[model samples]
Target: MTMVENVRNGLLIGAGPRGEEGREPWFLDPREILRTVRLRWITVLLPVLLLLGLAAAWTHLNPPQYAASTQILIDPRGLQVVKDGLTPPDQASDASLLLVDSQLRVLTSDDVLGRVVDRFDLAQDPEFQGRETLLGALKGLVARLTGRTEPPADPRLAALRILRDRTGARRLERSFVLELGVTSEDRDKAARLARGVAETYLARDAATRSDTTRRAGEAIEGRLAELRDALRKAEDKAQGFRARHNLVGTRAQLVSEQQLTQLSDQLGAARAKALEAGARLRQIEGVLAGGPSDSVNEIVQNPTITALRGQLAGVERLRADAEETLGRRHPSYQAALVQEKAVRGTIQAEIRRIAAASRNDYQAALASARTLADTLERRKADALKVGDDFVQLRELERQVEASRAVYEAFLVRARELQEQQRLDTSASRIISPASPPEKRLGPPTPVVFAAALVAGLGLGLVGSLGLELLAGRVRSRRRLEGHLGRSGLDALPRAPRGVAGAGAFRASFGTARGDGSYEVALARLRHRLAAAAPGQRPLVVLVTAADDRTGKSVLARALALSAASDRERVILVDTDPKGLVTRDLGAAAPRDLPATLRERGTLGEALITLASGLQVLPRPSDLPRDLAGRLADALLRSDADLVVVDLGLVGGNVVTERLIADERIPVLLLAVSARRGRLAAVDRALKAIGAGRRPRIVVTDVGARD
Candidate 1:
């Protein structure tokens, strides 16, 4: 029989039902997924082993490559022109990173790569030039036959590409050092290429620096010429202004000091001479007046005046003698008197001459003093004019000095640039040269194998999971509810070991009332059923399963037993033709369900009340096809506060379908653990029945009953 037909037969005869069975709980059940994977062990293991083998083969075929590395110092400290305080720490660090990155780009640029290629003559190398090997030739032939375009054949480009791939440059973290590495099949070749690339880069960097410095020097020279011309013009303007103002001295003075000093001395001498001359003139006048003539030093010092005085004294003596010798009018007395008068007249003439000479001397001295005073006043006026000129002169001097200073500064900068152009080089340098590598860079044998194993296992796991999901299994209670558009009532555990029939499980269901996992699950199922049924008046619940081997019969029994234990009268009608429930309850089959449908028997005549106040109507009938309305009518009239019906194997069974089609009855769908394709089929079937009520779902175990 087909699987569905067999399941239908099993449900009727108390045989273990079969088909798609068992759904896991809503959350991911890792244990179940793992169990599924284990079930397809070969499918998982074969691919894994194959992948590992391929990895191993690849590792063996490929030759190992050696890497050679050189260390370069990226000294951008020279590029930091700003003072430390001027730049923030974060900004400085960012700039340094940018500078280092720029240098790294240059190191790997086409120019540097081309130079390395040329210097090493990499065009002749087979690896770089992509020379045709036997395998490559075959592949090319195949491509041509297949009308495929061949790859480019430029040897220089090919060499460049190869060189780029083999070379790498990276900056060491938080440091000014860079590392350059080259990989090659030949250890010595790798070292040689690495060293060659580094040297070529250094040379290029130096040449670039020299070219930059040379251009800077030329620019500085141009600026220097402009500054020099400006300085010259400033100096010339200052000089011309100085000449115009006659401000010729290095410093301005208040007066012509030397001339002023000489004139002052001359003026003092002239005043002294004038005072002496005036004193002499006064003395002469005093002597002529006959007042203290002895005090007249000038008259006493004059030889002519002294002689005249002596003669006058002698004449006076002779006159006195004559007067004594001869009485009145004697000739000797007359002659002495006349001589004394002449001497007096001569002394008067001499005194008058002296007075005239003194007046002439005083006039000459006054004239000299006046001339010295006038010259000194003229010198002071000229000195004041010179002092006024000094202000503009000093400003012009300052301009000239400033321009000169600027011009000289540019001249010094230009000279420095010239020196730099001669000796300019890059700030970076290769601190350590590459050497031949002692060890190959490829993974070791053991490590490769281990990694291959891990990778293979991962691929296998992924492939197995993919297959399991693709099997279209319902997989979880959440998915089942999603397909059915309703929530599940419960998720019950699998029956424990040695628990055989639904009858054995139900008989002992309430014995372990103390929160055993299975007992708790059944109690929850009972509670949800009560809640799902419409308000209180003898709620009739129809419990059916999508597929078989799920404990639909046992679930109904547990629900009725729970209601009975709660002091409510409950009845379980096993509508399945198999009489599985009747055997479990140890109750004889009541009357055939068709007899009751024909009104020969009542539902109460078929009811058997247990010690727990729960009643069972086992194996109601081998349902008659045309008695659908009669069976539903008899089922509804049972004598109980609650009615639980176990309709096993729902789809393709007309009797079960007829019972589920009752509008007043609520349907509870029981899902087996493996609900691969059956849950969807059951959903479609129920929809076709169109009872206008969504069935509540309950996930159940397949292999074991609960």
Candidate 2:
């Protein structure tokens, strides 16, 4: 592919999926972003409310804050003098930060606090010495009961820390505009204080610079005077030598000749250096490209040797300069021998290169120079032979003379410059003078109030919603029915005032005839049961539950009434101790359901005839422990076309397994909550009832919105 196509394809691959399906992008769902915003809205609201509430309470309980502000211009560049005419960029920043940070420390010191207390004359606030009247005692008691600790921050520290905290010094991007802001309760004081700081800092800057320049001038002056005396003596000596020897030249001409001779000597040395550099460069290039492999330990890497050679050349240049200026006897002149000896050690590994090409170059250069020097000596017979001792003395005398001349000049100039520096303060002058600001730089009042108000509104909504969430209760029929694992009869409408709450026969078949209600639902439940067992007259419909109040009583009545409407002999029975099948008809909590096993006994006679072609035997009051065996016998009886029993509370009033001793009877259980109410407890009870008691759990109530 062409470059553009290749680049496009690569980007497409990166952006698109590696496999057939791509992962979702960062922000595909706006709803998730909305959710995040909502959460953050609460977080932001919390802090705003806390700060404003405390501030408001503080104002109401105590006195109003007398606000003051000061305005000052900060040098955005944070420039400070390190030395006159030598203020480095890095040094100025370091100095400015050090000064500002130090000043901030000073503002927080005990000194400032002592000043503020003395100025304000505030030694008699009531809190300072507690006075307890009856009301005050009561209020203090209430405050203690509620665990409220509301003491104000120290006013002096409060003032300083407010500036220290809110004070912003920010430099505008790519420009020299700095923002120096401070907020205080006292507007006039804040303004004056800021201006005072600005003025004091400027004065300090000027004074410090002036003193530094004066000190530097004095130090240089002393050295300059000594150098002046030495220069005079050097001049006298030079003149004496010239007069004694009858040397013919102006003083200026003699100096120029000396400089020319020095350059001429260096020129030859520089050429020798060039030759050395070239050889080293060639050796390095050869190694850098490729060198023959070596097995011997003595063999050196040529690149390493070449680097050492460059350093040796640098030493040679210094040696040449020392020899030319010093006569051969100076310490530097003597040290040249020692340095050359070290270079020779470093060069030992490069014996091959020196043997090949550079040995001849060095010999030719050195021999040519010595021969020229000998010729110069013959030309001037009185000229000294240059040795280390002679070189030392000559160079020392020359340096002292040169330094004397330069130092005298520097002394005169520095004195003049120091005076000029003291006066040249306008360059660093305050560009914008500090003045009392017309308005304080705290956040705009309306903006702050609006932010705080919005925050409160948001927080209030969250608190309301959170409370609603925590108070979970059942509200819908579907959730309850789902928990029961059966379609519950929403057959009966809510009872009208003064009407029969039982809805009598009307609540059966999942329908209320007079109520004009969920009889429609009862009709559906009837259809489902009949369809399941078509043409089966002896169909067994067992109704039971794991726990109480799971709509088991309501379900039994509704089913029986539905089947009875279809001309089936429906006998509504209350097998639970918590309720009587007829208890609303017979009207009492059942004490037992299991002990009534006989066809003709007290349990059997408990049957009450109802108006709607149904015989209802209400449960007698008996504890569950007295009825388990009888219940097994009673359940096995085959008399009624449909027998519906009101079950007891699951895991509450009765353990179900003991009651359901007859396993042949298939069980249907009721549950009050499908998803939310404790399911594990219901499940464990069902499991205890054994596999034969196949209790189907139906939910009764669970809903998010109640």
Candidate 3:
């Protein structure tokens, strides 16, 4: 499709229903378009704002000056001539448009503006034409600073050019319409410039008409002289022919006399011969046919005799056939011979009849000769009577030729005059005239406004979408779960309550109802623990976290419920000094490591039973070089099939490190969202925990979706 066709098709289709199966109504669905626009709003608006700001600044800071125009309308035929009409001469539409554009160039030319500058003495101005006064010098200094007062063109031409550049003068497409526009801060100046163009057009029109008419007259005069000379030559040839041919009438009369004499004699002789032959032929034919024939030609001319001869021939053939059937000496043979003889005699008689008929034809020729003699005498008399009248046609032909010459000259002159009149109009027609444009032609305001609005919207969308694309924050649930390397058993939203509700995990983990948040998390963890190492003795599950406040105590409680809820006794340990996990889960504050070691009991006695089947033990407040001191009292979950111990944050710095390290307890790694749950962080924590033996990695605070 052509560009125009595509544009037209788009317009037509845009106006029609544009929809697809299972989609929103085309025009009404702004979501996709709006989304794209929002994404680019900032990109589009920034440039628009710049343009608007520049426009505003220009309007405020720049002093507006008026632009004027002076137009000279030329016929482009190079006629330099004028014709009828007060308006500019009418021209072909295309030619007229060309003239307008050419005029535009001429108006902007430096030569023209130079004249205006010199005439106006513009160099003496305060800014331009003024003399070098203090104000002029100050303005010059300012111009130097701003680089404003620079011109490569003549001032007058520059002025005109400024006007022309701001103005529009063009013929309407394919029509006899021309408009001129001049824009200026001074409306009167614009009007004056436009009016001046019309004035200039009028002057041009007059000069062109005068030149056209004058040249036409001269051309016609020159052609007419050539025609006159040609006419003279034709006439001279006719005159010379007449002088040379003095025999013209004589030759015509002689030829006519000769033809007349010959025709008269031949007519007389033909009549005499026809009569003599008729009498002689009658006598001969009468004797032969046994009757006095009116004319033998009449008898001989009849076709019946020839037909009878043919019949006789057929009868002879039949007789011959009879002879062939019989013998030569028989009666049948003799009879056939007799019949053949009779038919031959009849043929001889017909020949005699023809000979008798022609003898009269000779007599008739003699009679016709006598008759021709009389006719010839009469024609001779007629020819003698009409003397020299045959010569008149020759003189008449000369007169006709002379008249044709005169007519040809007159026709030539008339055609020349006709052609001159036609050239008179065609040679100097003005293609277009000057008039103010009703609507100014320039950068369209509505388009500019629409563009700016779209640009602004686009810029805003761009800023928003760009930030989204460049961001390295939380993305989707899949990536979050991938970091954990396990199922996201449960999750929490960003709640203001923090970790206080962790006691529910403890309660859910076979703990008392008063210990709320920790019970819930523990129950989930306990379920995992029971499934992971089912029906195993000394099923110790060591818990550790990446950082503080990651619900380690709660996990231990939930794990304990999974173990002892089925009548299995379970022990819990908090190796974190801060007791953050214990406090959030409503457990008693943890004691110092040294205090536990100082007790009479071993590590098993350090555990405090919070409910029927669950017990809590936390990290110590003092230092213990070795947790092996408490290992002697290490509490075994005799009443439970599983046990969960909170090893707290991983590292040698933590007090629980050696308990797992030296004792070789099975450790479970726990990570939380607050400590940056990314694959990199997970890998780092994995590496740290892997320093001793591999630990089971678990995650906390992963989200769930509908």
Candidate 4:
């Protein structure tokens, strides 16, 4: 069977009587909610109209604010014209973000804002002076009512506060561009202020850069003077050290060292000359001491000696001739011998003279060499004595050179800084200047109205739900289902008043003249019962209520009539001890079901057939103890295609409970009026029936009773 059928037949109450496991709760019905909203539409419209009127008045009383913005590009590369040991601009993501943030702070800083304020004389502007606007007036009134006083503020401070509030700066996403904006009541003023802020910031930045360069140059120049003094002092100390030590020197050599070198050269030449003279003296002495004069090259090569040797040979020849001619002393032979002797004597004198001269020359050379050696030794000692002073002089000269080098470096830097001061410019520049805006700041009037409408509708829906909750009535099928914890079958209209006995049933369920809504409700209930069974066996529909006045008997008869009109065999059983079905259907002298069962042993004998072909089984005034058994037997014996039992005021009798407990039977809970206590009783009845039997709730007398 389908879930709906199972629920109707009380086969799956664990899933909730209304099959609410996967279904929306009955109270959430959109149509019902809309109906509630329609009933209290004024609640929604009031808020909408009120908000719209307030928006209109606000717009009329207050002047529109206009916003103007200027764009600045923060390019670090712009300051690359001169490098003066300043930090280079970074373009990496992290560095760029930091630089942009720092620049943004500077752009909105008091210094930049102060310049703008001074340029525009904003301290005198009425807006900046805190003139009483609508909001300001409201604040003042509230302050007065609260008995609070505010201290007077300085004009400059007030102008600064207002300027800061109206001006803002933000960097464009992932870029070096910044957008500075200003808002004011006057469009021209807004544009001018925006431009003023941008210009002021740029000018301040440039001035800061130039001033920084100038200060750097001044510092370098000051340091340069110190270095210059240090260099001069170093040079003077070197010169004084040299003078104090008597350490005189050319750039490449000392004076004592030069004298020592000259003496060393003179000593070497004198020693060489002495050795030559001694060698010549030895040769002459050897020749004089009986060595062969002719063997000596010096004596052999002498011109006087050579001539004397020739004369000696001639004199020997003459003497030999004289000895032979004249016997002992011939005068001519004697003359020849004398002449040879004289020539020999002359040769001997010349040799002795040359040897003497050689000795004298050697003696003079030895004396000169000895004197020069003595002078050279003294000069070397003097040079060694001044070695420490020369070292100190070199250190002083090195210090002077170092000082000069440092001075030159600083001097170069100072010049560069001076040039930088001349060319200094800001890293940021205006990329797009501010212009007067055509439209005001905030949303247009129509958009505000639409927003108010939506807000009003939402509040209206909330109000409707609250009102419905407050009423706490089951006025519709959905409300009935929600109240009873079961699916609603149908909502039957109340019968017209003044119709008594069977006339009420005729007016509600008459085939030709019945109320359309009541008849249609009955037909719908009949169809639901047929659908719930869907079997060849007779469909048993039990109609019960929490209490009387629920019109359960009337609904049971109407259901039977609606089925009979469809050409189906329908039996209307009134199981109430009050005989409500018999009285309402106008069935005269209805045989008691139990008595008929005891006498005839068949429910067919007790059934009263109506003119509409609907059979009725009316209950006695007092129910018998075995009434449940007799009713079951009577139902089995009958051949009706549909059976609708009227069990009035359920939970009041044991027989009704026993009949409702049957799982095969579909029960309809009639709810004519919903009260908190009555709903509680219905809930208790459902729980007592157990999850194995779920009943369908039928709301009757809907509009008229609720």
My TM-score estimates for the predictions, one after another, are 0.42, 0.47, 0.40, 0.56
Give a tens-digit lDDT track for model 1, residues 345-401.
898898899899999999999999998889989987777777666777778778888
Ranking by lDDT: 4, 1, 3, 2
Candidate 2 lDDT over 49-113, as tens digits, reads 88578556544454323333332333324343323353333446556665445544443344543
Could you tell me how far off, in angstroms, the CA of residue 706 lies in candidate 1 after the best superposition? Answer: 23
What would the TM-score be for candidate 2 when compared with the true structure?
0.47
lDDT of 4 by residue, 1-706 (tens): 1223323322211122334421344347776676666666887677777877877777776668899999999885556675534646446678767877899999999999988888999999987876567778898889989989697688988899999998998989878899999999999999999999998888888888889889988988989888999999998998898888888777456888888888888889889988988887788788777676866666788888888898898888888888888843889788987898898888778788878988898999999999998888788787889988888788888898889999998999888888888775556789999999999899877776778777877777777677766765454555656655445345555644523246644533444444354555565555566666677357777888765443666666667766777677888888776777677766553456667766646777777776667777777666676667667656755678888888856677888888877654654554444322245555666677677766676666654322
In candidate 3, which residue ranges exceed 4 Å CA deviation? Answer: 1-76, 80-104, 110-471, 479-490, 494-529, 536-572, 577-579, 582-604, 611-614, 623-669, 674-683, 686-706
TM-score of 4: 0.56
Off by over 4 Å in 2: 1-162, 170-179, 184-200, 217-411, 425-512, 516-519, 536-540, 558-569, 580-583, 587-606, 621-641, 651-677, 685-706
Q: Kindly state the number of residue pairs that clash in model 3.
A: 98
lDDT of 3 by residue, 19-97 (tens): 2321332113244335434445666567668766655554444445444433333444444233333235456667766
Q: In order, what lDDT does every prediction score?
A: 0.70, 0.50, 0.50, 0.73
Best by TM-score: 4
